[model samples]
Target: MSKKTEFQALDLISAYSEKKKNPSHLELNQIFPNPTQPRLIGREDTADLVPSMERLGLIEPILVRKDKGKYLIVAGERRYRAAIKLGWKEIPAIVTDANEDVCYEMSLAENEKRKNLNPWEVGKAIQYLRKEKRKTAEEVSELLGYSGRYVKQLSSIARLDQKSVMELMISGKPLSVKNLEELLKRKENRGGETISPRPGSGSGRISINLSKLNGRVRDNFLKELGLLKKKYGINE
Candidate 1:
């Protein structure tokens, strides 16, 4: 087997071992939502999933970790909720001994199985991997199947103020990376300054023409930019 396959098998074995020790069943009261879950599941989305679950039953078990006397969901929240909606007494679950980092990673990976995660959700997951797990952009790109360029862009979006991020989440509008980059640029410029370079227009938006700088100055500026990024923990 490939190294990745081997690692995944080991993880399966570990989870199975933990389940044997815990022997959990997903009783309604016993299962809790993950406190740190970043993705939101609207009732509309769950409405569709409920029918499939009713017809086929749960094809996969939800993953959970022990919390005090209860089990907190590590993955498969939609399945858990659908089962509850159908008034099912219990559902299958695998209780694992995964730590906080592993739990977060597992939840992220599980959500990605359908590749339906929102851009904000993707950004948050990448942020967790970068900041919490201390992974590089390349590492996150490989783990999450995002392009290297897009991963850096997502990382930048994650660094925005939490209030702005919260506002975006509340808007519930689909996010485009291009739009997010534009938002970031305006935020950095302060007061939503216009960034377009139009003829016979003035908006007090600062514009830099790199060609105006001498080679040495440009090189030095690039070096300084790198240093600033490193200092501020910006990824690119």
Candidate 2:
């Protein structure tokens, strides 16, 4: 289909712009999480999409709203990031009349339509919604089409330190959610202590569980993993 025709068919923007009858394109200044959004744009994905936009122009316009004179992107963060990376001066965008709540819901819906999130990412997103958006775990569960227990699981995954999470994501290895849960349980058992091994617990068999290690421990684990791969000449 033609690009303009495709843009016209995107009912989300058209429905919102129908009243104004004169929606204008705007630059993306702010990006906000869509509560109902599902898709996530990783670095590699951005690289691919940016080149595509440079070649074809943006087939779909992003949705946004005016916020204190700056445009806040309610949907299409991936597209925005791609445009910025491609050095596009102006992007086709549809101004939406959707309220904050509606925008958030639409964004979340858009994101969720993609493939499922990894356990760790899901955990982070759910926790962000609960903490930043002030939504209850139950509320997030309902909105995200996840069970309350599942939402809690995601929150638990988010609690792991950043270094550990990134290592898992980059390793391209499948992590055992059960193992992670056990690790979380162990960390909790330490009475809210940090994710690191306790100091001076010397020779006490520090009971290292593969799951709960984050930050430095996670880094160390990756290093050790590399050594093991070299030592054993393992290839997968």
Q: State which candidate has the highest TM-score.
A: 1
Itemize residue pairs with steric clashes in candidate 1: none
Superposed by TM-score, candidate 1 places the C-alpha of residue 143 at a distance from the truth, in angstroms, of 4.1
| TM-score for all models, in order of appearance | 0.62, 0.59
After TM-score superposition, what is the CA distance of residue 132 in candidate 2 from its true location, in Å?
3.4
lDDT of each: 0.67, 0.60
In model 1, where do residues sit more than 4 Å from their true spots?
Answer: 1-24, 40-45, 133-148, 160-174, 187-236
For the record, the alpha-carbon RMSD of candidate 1 to the native fold, in angstroms, is 8.3
Q: How does model 1 score by TM-score?
A: 0.62
Q: Candidate 2: which stretches are off by over 4 Å?
A: 1-23, 28-45, 175-236
Q: Write the per-residue lDDT of candidate 2 for residues 1-236, one digit (tens) a residue.
A: 10111211134433664534454666544444343443432523576687788899887777776666567776677788788788766777777767776566565554444433456665666676777789987677666667665666667767776566556557775654554554566655743223223456333433456777778988987788677557544453
Candidate 2, residue 161: Cα displacement in angstroms equals 2.3
Q: Alpha carbon lDDT of residue 51, candidate 2?
A: 74
lDDT value, residue 148 of candidate 2: 60
Q: Residues 6-96, candidate 1, lDDT per residue (tens digit)? A: 1121243344544544445668788988877757534125887899999998877778889899988877788888888999999888877
